[model samples]
Target chain A: MMLNLAPNIADPDDFYAELVNSQRNLDEEQALRMNARLILLLANHIGDRTVLTEAIARARAAG
Target chain B: MTNHIYPKFGYLRSKEQADGVVKRHPIVVIGAGPIGLTAALDFAARGQPVVVLDDNDTVSIGSRAVCYAKRPLEIWDRLDCASPMVDRGVSWKVGKVFFHDQLSYQFDLLPESDHQWPAMINLQQYHLEEILVAKCRANPLIDLRWKHRLISLKQPADHATLAVETPDGIFTMEAEWVIACDGANSDTRKMVGAEFTGQFFQDRFLIADVAMKADFPTERWFWFDPPFHPGQSVLLHRQADNIWRIDFQLGWEADPDAERQPERVIPRIRAMLGEDAQFSLEWVSIYQFACRRIDNFRQGRVLFAGDAAHQVSPFGARGANTGVQDIDNLAWKLAMVLRGEAPEALLDSYHEERAYAADDNILNSTRATDFITPKTKVSRYFRDAVLELAQHHGFARPLVNSGRLSVPTPYATSALNTPDEDFAIGEMRPGTNAADAPISVAGKPSWFLHCLGDGFTVVTFGKATDKTGIAIGPLAAKIIRVGRDIEDPSGLLAARYGASPGTTYLFRPDQYVAARWSGFDETKIIEAMLRATGQDSARHPAGQKELAA
Candidate 1:
């Protein structure tokens, strides 16, 4: 059975938007994506290479 | 015996004594916070020498992370002192949201599985630390030193040299590696020139643990635009000692001190409650959270974990959970490299796997925080709209909860992977391949293997096959009889992971599944293990295909 795979739990592209979304000026979606990016960037900084590569793949898997 | 650690010699001392006692360990964990201490416990459980240091005079007495998730409880079980924590903690499964004194929504957190531990437990963070401190104290190998402040740290080829300022004076200690479980403001990370770049919220929130009386429902309650609180909202969580953690989302520009006055805070509560309520404030903290991460977890022999690596808002309880996972990924591997069993590349995977996990945690928490407490005018409007819609539409509630946001991080696909379908999606790959070791030999071990949550076990089957990675450990291999229906020795593993016969699993001194293999392809599986533990898999019992095949 060929099943469609969803993205990995950690997607990096949404990094910046998720971090700053909490700002009263930013939209909720923007803040969420900012929050997501901040998390991804931090992980990238930590050198969790395999998880990072896989996370990138997870992000790309959808659609 | 040659490599075992003695607790009294390991950690939590004044800066001066530690400066004088020159010693080397695979990892020297700084700061015995929940995450830091968990890392030390896992490292010690892996039969490696570890020295843990903390500058705090006592076990955390502050309003740190009080909400314990199910995953962390699993870790505490591995540390061999979960009973006290479970006994003292309160389990809350039912929660509701109230809008202006009317109950709007309710939900249950019990995910179906045949496990005994509740999904979420409420205990003081200090209580959890107290239990962990006892476990760390019991471990002859995990050293716990409190009140020892880290002044300076240098990363060398073989170790990260730490110069700590303790009660006595300055002293130096050498370790094969240094793992920083330091807080968000890590001096070690700063000293190594790693930049923590991200958003710092200008808005401040008031988090108060209080004892109160009111007609409000006794569940996890969230109020959206209550009468008195026109703009702000309240999050009430019942905690130990008849205390409730209340968070008021005071906008970024509001005066912090004004919210503290009994005249200011109590009237607001009374106005919303529709009656007078008596309450005593336990602790009130103003937190302007940061969504930040250090650029890298490692610089030479030094590594970062916990809050030192990444920080997120308190929503969804991911911060400490992700940090605890940091130790989960690194501890056993450090034990292996120090024991001369695996390659240095294995240590590199810790950063790989955990950094990914940390990344996910930060994003999840960030998303949840943004939704729950929006900063912008549109988001605030949209959030109110979402809540209003939720009041009428059942569809919106679950949609909101889906991203309540959390997951255990793993390296399912990477340079370390074999390109399976599961890996294609970045989900946790569950299969018997060349990589996994069985959880038990008596029966088919669990793929998500645990050692009844204690002690170390090496699992393999078929009258014995010598594996490379199993050679260096405090525990021995679990040899299985492939076709035999033994009483489920690892019933919990079966419940958690659903493993069948002819499987191999290697459980660390902590009960977490280190690596699992489908069957006897010795080299490939050992290679993954070796890579994980910072050793060379190319040496003995080599499997060239673990990565390639």
Candidate 2:
């Protein structure tokens, strides 16, 4: 399966703000783990190994 | 409750007090703890006179600050004290982390070989102090004054005078420079009005040093929510003399007094060490730690090092290791400034570099504290998730925070570092501490770090040559030709330093890389030394062609 290249979420700016606000008042470690949990939850929802592997590769390449 | 007996040195009246005259010394170190005594030893190594004052005449009561890292051992080696420590201390490299009786992850601190010292060692603070005190007593350049307490400090325009109360009487003494190594509750810090600020943890940990004859392996074992103590963290480490140091986390609501009693502490130890294990209680104490540092490490003619300047949680074994590095970065600069080889502004870089390292330590300690004692339910859930994954996955292993074992902090953004003229490889950047390797000096077996003198060193990786005219401003740079003067038998030194035939490296007095170039350039080397000594203010922008020109 091919990982989607185009933006998929509606109102991307609002979603980004909400994603950041989810970690409000959290310490650095707490916020990092929260992000880790968020990634795991989203990966479960996607539920595609090939897509997840491609996404991971893309993330690594971007960094 | 401690089984070990404390050694005491009776107070003696100083000749200055007997003469009823105030004497001014070159350096005055307050508090004869490990840091203060080490400072005195460092000054003596440079052939400078130092007077060390302590309120008491004995080593500290409890077995505090047990773990000593490799960097500090190297520093002690320079002062001719590492041999006794390594001989007496228990050294280990591997640490295992468990989550509720299940192994979560394990780590090897020093996977690479060919180093002089081990990754880390565990020896009680009192034992370390006893070793250092003996060294100080042997050195003629050091004066150890026992039972002398500082009453007040007055800093004038020219110098600072300390009024100390001894067994004889209160007397005044002066110093060109004063160092405060008076531990966490520093009276010198309060007297000098140095503002200390940071996070205050609302948790308590019970530290018990137990003497036992068990056959436990000499490795660090940490547990989170184990069966012995549910919903809490426990750390186990081995020290010298058949003693084991155990730290049990008791939440903020636990009573400090009740937790210290043997009746309450024995059951906790029995649950972890098994009920039939015969162990005698050596020492038991309750402590609450904070991750805080002073506003500045230097205040005019007076400076602070060790716990007097910064405080951190004991989780990472950072408390004394970081402090020893502070003194390592400080003493040479102070010597140069005192001898008028460098400008007084050179002292400012001590604050710049050490304060940066202090912040790094505090950040690590704070992160570890937060993970081990999560404040929020969501955070604890994430921590548990990471632990659960760590048992089966490799990626999650990095997320486990069983106190990021103390490592030397690189001054990446220090002003003293000259931008590299050559592309850098490996970890040997401008402000990074020098790494050691196996080498032969003139056909005899020796370590690479043993070749560094107490002055600036210029290492060129080619044949021997007459580099006599090479001098960095007023300071002469000792030239060491690796191929001719020192042979890299296994080529590990050259490989670790990323050196070619003509590669040239300049190291500071403290053995930190100041700058490196692909080829030897006299002008560039001098400029780098000037910049490292805070003599040059011009910034050498990275990747600039002007250096080539």
Candidate 3:
């Protein structure tokens, strides 16, 4: 499957707020771990090889 | 002073003091440390008169700045002082990094062969200084004055007048140009009122120089949270005279004075080297480094180089290596400006180019320091994760920064560079340091770097019949025809420059590539030389018209 480039989240602001809220009151180290787990969980959910590679490339290039 | 003997040159009164005359010199270099002495040698080699003043009579007291990189060695080779240093130094090219008890990464610094020097050589600061001081004393043009300090500096646009304190008394002297290599705590920097700003590392490193006779190979060994020192990093390197330099990372809260005691230090070494290892402490010191630099390298007639101009953490051996390159970049520019061959505006490029290098060094140093000693909890976790991943994954190996091990960064964005018009493979581009390849000169084996003259060079790959007269404005560019003046029999030189024949590379006086062309074009070469010398304003159409004839 092709990686989705356009906005797909129905409620983008609410989703961002939920993502931020998930790590609320957590220490910096714990928040970092939570982010890592979140990334791996989302990566496994989208199990398309080409899409995963493109997503990783896009994230690194944006950096 | 404990294990090694310091040689005292002693104080000597100058003839100017005896005559009681305030004489003016061509160039005055402050601080006879490695940087100042090397600058004096370079100036003298260029037939320039120089006077070096230092407060102390002896070389550096301890084994500081251990790792000397390849570029600095090549610079010293041109100055005729690399032989003894290489002879006495412990040359190494392999480095091993460990996480706890397991090996994380291993690297070969110089994989290719035929180069004159190794990737790096570990030598004490004092020993290198002595070798440089002896070379300086032998040169008549270098007037090295020991036990003489600069009391005050007065810059008057045209020249700088310095009040020097000596054994006799305070005497005044003048120099057309003054270079301050007085090191990190520079009095000359304070005198000039230049703003030095950067990040100060909150951590400390306890440098322990211990003399030991061991069977271990000469290599750099670094550890991240090793079993011997849990939660702290350690660096190990072997120097000359059987002295092994070990740096132990101490957090900011560790008491600097209490940690330096032999009672506290001996146990740590014993834990690292095992219970039965025999060694004697040669020197010990707790140092907190700051990565900072002066806003500009040049102020009026006075200039700053080495640690006086910029400071960096001990990681990557950027301290003295970067300092040597600073002098390498500045000395040639100063010589050109003084000789009237180049305009005074050429000196501004010194600050531009070297400050770029200084910023690069500070960034690398800060990154390494942060990785080695993470200030925040998340940073420490990230560093630990990288170290853990480094053992299994190739991608994480590059992320593990145990001091990026000092390689000269190319000034790719330098204004002096004529952006490559012809495609060439490999890393040899405009504004990059010239790489050395083994070649034969005069029917004898000689390196590629040794054959380059003391001025701008056009390294052209051609046969004996292909001789061209190329001039860079008033200056004639020295041409080294690869197949004639030098022979690349193994084809390494040609391969490195990406040339079969008819490729020309214009090199600056400091041996950095200014431009390269597919064929011998005098106009393009002259234009590049004009730009390199900061005469780009004359690089317009009319000036090109005048230059065409």
What's the true lDDT of residue B298 in model 2? 90
- List clashing residue pairs in candidate 2: B2-B282
Candidate 2 local lDDT, B1-549, one digit each (tens): 777888987798999999999999989999999899999999889878999999999998877999999999999999999999999999999999999999999999999999999999999999999999999999999999999999899999978999999978899999999999999999999999989999999999999999999887999999999999999999999999999999999999999999999999999999998989999999999999899999999988899999999999988999999999999999999999888777788999999999999999999999999999999876787788778778987767888998998999999999889887668545699999999999998789899888887988889888535574366446668888887778998999999999888888889989999988888887788788878888773554431233223
Per-candidate RMSD vs. true structure?
11.2, 6.6, 4.8
Interface DockQ per candidate: 0.03, 0.13, 0.13
Weakest ten-residue segment in model 1 chain B by summed lDDT: B1-10
All candidates' TM-scores? 0.74, 0.90, 0.90
Best by lDDT: 2
| Candidate 3 local lDDT, residue B505 | 88
Residues B135-175 of candidate 1: C-alpha lDDT, one tens digit per residue: 88888897777667788888766667888776676788777
Error of 2 at A58 (Å): 20
Q: Per-residue alpha-carbon lDDT of model 3 for B1-549, expressed as tens digits?
A: 276889999999999988999999989999999999999999988889999999999999888999999999999998999999999999999999999999998889999998999899999999999999999999999999998989999988699999999989999999999999999999999999999998898888899999888877898999999999999999999999999999999888999999999998989999999999999999999999999999999998888999999999998999999999988998888888888777898888898899999999999999999889888776677777777767887766777899988988788899889988767545689999999999998789989998786788888887523544566446567778887788988888988888866788889989999999878776778888888888773556564445444
DockQ for model 3?
A: 0.13
Q: After superposition, how far is residue A53 of candidate 2 from its true place, in Å?
A: 19
